[model samples]
Target: MLWRAISEELPGPKWAGLFAEYWPFYRKWWLKEGEPARPTYAECRRALKAHMPDLIPLYEDLCDQAGGGDLAARFLSFYCPPPYLSGCSQAVWGGKEPVMVRNYDYNTNAFDSLVLHTGWKGRRVMGTSDGLFGLVDGVNDAGLSISLTFGGRRVVGVGFGVPLILRYVLQTCETAEQAGEILARVPTHMSYNVTVLDRKRKYLTALMAPDRPAIITKAAVATNHQENVEWISHARFTATVERERYLLQRLRFHRDPEEKFINTFLKPPLYSHQFNAGFGTLYTAVYRPRKREMEHRWPGTVWHQKLDAFEEGSRNVLMPGIVA
Candidate 1:
C-alpha cells in the first residue's frame, strides 16, 4: 500500500498542452487583472525553460505519458481564477514558517509527517496537460515539507517569480536547506515568504526577497509578512513596516509540537466565512503521510472541506488522490 501510494504515475502528451493552455489565465489573475508591463508569456516561458531545462522536459514527458492536448481544452472550460485573499495567516505548532509544520516520531521511525497551508495558488501536474491548479499545500516523497505565505510590497522588478519558485521547490529540492540555496541565487520579480522543512525534521527556514543576501533566522514562527532582519530592512526599510507588525504578533505563541495546530484552527464553524473572513485564513490544509507505520492526528476531513472551497472558487478539479 505504501509503495503504491508513492508510486510515480506519469501523464500523457495531451495533459502537457492543457498545462500550457492554463498558464495564460493563471498569469492573468496573478498579475492582477489588467496591469500592464507584466511579464510576457514568452518571457515567463523562457525563464522557466532556461533555469529548469531538465524539469521542463520531464514535465513534458509526464504530460505526454499521461495523454495531453484535448484533455486540457476540455478542462480549460472549468478553469476558474483563484481568489486574491484565499490564503491563511495562522500558526503551525513546531512550525518554522507561518503555515508549515513537520513531526518526527523517533519511537516509531516514522521518518516524518507534515502539514502545509498556503495562500495564492498551487498546482499538481501528472504528465503535463491535465494538471490541476490551487494546491496551496503538499508533502514530498522525501518527507520534506513546504508552505507559502503572501508578501506584499510597493517596489517591483522583472525576473523569474513566485509560482515558478514554488514549482521549483516542489520539483527539485529534497530538504529545507536545498530549497534555501535555490532561493539564495534565483532572481524574483516580487516579494514572498517561503518556508521549508527538511527530512530529518531538524530545521525550518524562511527566505524573503528583494535583496541580494538571504537571512537564516532561527524561529519556530513566521507569517505573511517580513520579519525584522536588519539587512533586509536596510534595503527596503520603509516599505515593509506593516508586514513586520503582523509577523511580530504571530510570534507571540510558542508552537506546541503535539497539537496538530492547523487542524485545530480549521474545524467546523471555524472553517466557514465567519472565521475565514474575520481572521483572513481563507483556506487551510493538513497532510500527514506517515501512518503507514505510525500514527498522528489526521485532518483529512478538514482538508476535504477546504478542498471543496478551493474547487468552487477556482473551477478547477481537485485531485485529492494524487497527493494521497
Candidate 2:
C-alpha cells in the first residue's frame, strides 16, 4: 500500500492550499453507487456545529486560510459524513499487558487518505487516514490507543463523526476509562465499533450510534458489527462473520502471542488483498502501549515508532512474503 505521511503542523491556510489539488475529485464523489447516501455539506455542517460547537473556529480558520472565496464547504469536508460501511478487525492481546492491533479497510475512492504523525502541542499523536484533521485509528503519547470500524447500519443522525471523537479522546484522555467516558458522552452521526486500549490491560469496546444507546461489550476483538449480531439486519458488510472467526481462531491457536505471532495479520483474514474500491487493507497498526511503541506495517517489513521519538515523513513500507 502507498501512503503519504505528514509531520509539522501546517497552518489552516497552508493545508487548504495543499488540499486544493484533491478537492475536486472527492467533492464530486458525494455518493458512490452502493454507498450509504450522505447529507450535503450544509446539512453536515449544521449538525456538526450544533453538536460540536467548539470545532467551528478551527473549521472556519482552515477554510479562510485555504484562500478560496467560496471554500467554507471545502474545509468542512473533514466533518462530512463518511462511508457508513467499512471493514476493520481489531484485537487486544497479551494476557498480562495487552497490545492493540487493527486492520482498517475502506473505499479508496472516498478519501484522499494518508497517515498523519501530528505535531499536537500537548500530546503526541499518530493516526491513520486523514493527514491533519480526523483519524480512523491512532495511538497517543499517553499510552492510549483507539481505532474504529463502521457499525454495519445505514442510519445517519444529529451527531459528530467517529474520527474527530477519536482525535478528541487522544488529545484529552490518558486512561482507558477516561477515553470511554468521553466516548460515552458524544453522539455519532453513524454507527461504529470503537475500541480503546491502555497500558493497564484495560481494553474498552463501545458499540455506538446516534439513534440508539451505546452497548458496552466485554470482548477483545471488535469487527464491523455490534456484539449482538442477531439484531443486525442492515449492515453493508457481510464478511464480518468470517473476519471475526478467523482472528479468534488464530488467537486461540496462539495462546501466548509474541512478536512473530502478532505479525501474522499481514497475511490473510486480517490483511486484505481486495483493493478495487477502498476496502483493501490499508495498514495494520500494532500498538504496544506498555512499550510506548507502534509498528507501521507492510507485508514483509515494518517501521518502528516510539512515543518519544518517531520518524516523521512519507516512506514506502514493504515486507516481501507478507503481502498476501
Candidate 3:
C-alpha cells in the first residue's frame, strides 16, 4: 500500500487531483445498483443540510472541486450510498498519555491509502482519508481523537456513511462527551462502533446502528460485534469474539507498559493478515490526543506526525507479508 500524507488548508488542486484519481472507482461502486437506485441530488443535499449542517459549506466546496456535477455532488454527500463493511479492533489505553489505538482491517484494493491534514473551517484535522473528504479515523487540534469498527451487523438502511460521521465528529467536537452526543444523534446507514478519546483520558464507545438508537458505553474495548453477535458467520469469519476477549484480557490481566501494550497489537490475532478475505490489517494507528500526535505503524516501519507540524510525504508498505 502506498500511504501518502498531504496537507492542504482548504479544498484546492490537491483535493481535486485526489477526486480525479479516485472518482472512477467511486463512480463505478456508487452506481453498482444503478443511478436511480441511489438518492437524488436534492435528497442528498437535504440530508447533509439536516444532519451535518456545519459541513454544507465544505461539502459544496468539495463538490465544486469534484467538477460540480450532480452525480459527484450526490456522491460527496455520502448520504445512503452503497453498503460497505470492514473488520477492525479499537480500544483506549488507560495506562497513560491519553492514547487510543486500532488496527484497520479491510480490503486492500478498496482503500484510499492516504492521510490528510487540513485546516478547514479554522480547525486543524488530520487522519486517514476515505471517500476523498470523509475520514476513517482522525484527530483535531482540540485534542480529540476518534476511530471506528464494523458493528458486526448486516443490515443497511437510510443514513450517512460512518466515514462522514467520523469526519463530522472531529470537525465539530472537542471532547469525548461532545463526540458521544454527535455519534448518538447522527444516523448511520450501517452498523459501526465509534470510539472517542479526549485529552483528559475520558473515553466512550458509541455503538451506532441504523435500525436502532446508538448505545453509548463506557467500555474501553470495541471489536466488530456489538452487545451480542448478530451475524454468526461474520462474527466467526472475523474472529470478532476471540479478538475482543484477547483485548479485554490484555487490559485486565496485564500491567503492560505503554510501549509493550502498543506492541501487542503488532503481533498475534490483533495483527491480521487475511487480505484475501477482505479484512486484513492494513495498518495500526496509534493516537495521543493530548499531544496531538499520531503514528501509522506497519510491522518494522513507523511514521509519526503531529498537528503542530504535519509534513507531506509518502511511503510504500508491503502488506500481508510484513516482517516484524
Which structure among the candidates has the greatest TM-score?
3
Worst lDDT run of 10 residues, candidate 1, spans 104-113
TM-score of each model, paired residue for residue: 0.55, 0.82, 0.98
Q: lDDT tens digits, residues 155-222, model 2? A: 77756768888877887779889887877777887888899999787888888887888877656778
lDDT of each: 0.38, 0.69, 0.92
Model 1, 1-324: lDDT tens per residue? 010011122443433444454456544544464434344434444655666554466544443443444333222222221222212332334443323432111111111112222221122221001124212345445555555544444344544445455556656666677877776666555555666655455445455565544456445444434554343542242223433343334345533344444444444322322221223223343433221011122234222312112221111222121222
Ranking by lDDT: 3, 2, 1
Predicted candidate 3 versus true structure: per-residue lDDT over 157-203, tens digit per residue? 99999999999999999989999999999899999999999998899
Candidate 3's displacement at residue 247, Å, is 0.5
C-alpha RMSD of candidate 1 = 11.4
Model 1 score (lDDT): 0.38
Better of 1 and 3 by TM-score: 3
> Between candidates 1 and 2, which one is better according to TM-score?
2
**Ten contiguous residues with the weakest lDDT in model 2:** 27-36
Candidates 1 and 2 compared: the better one by lDDT is 2
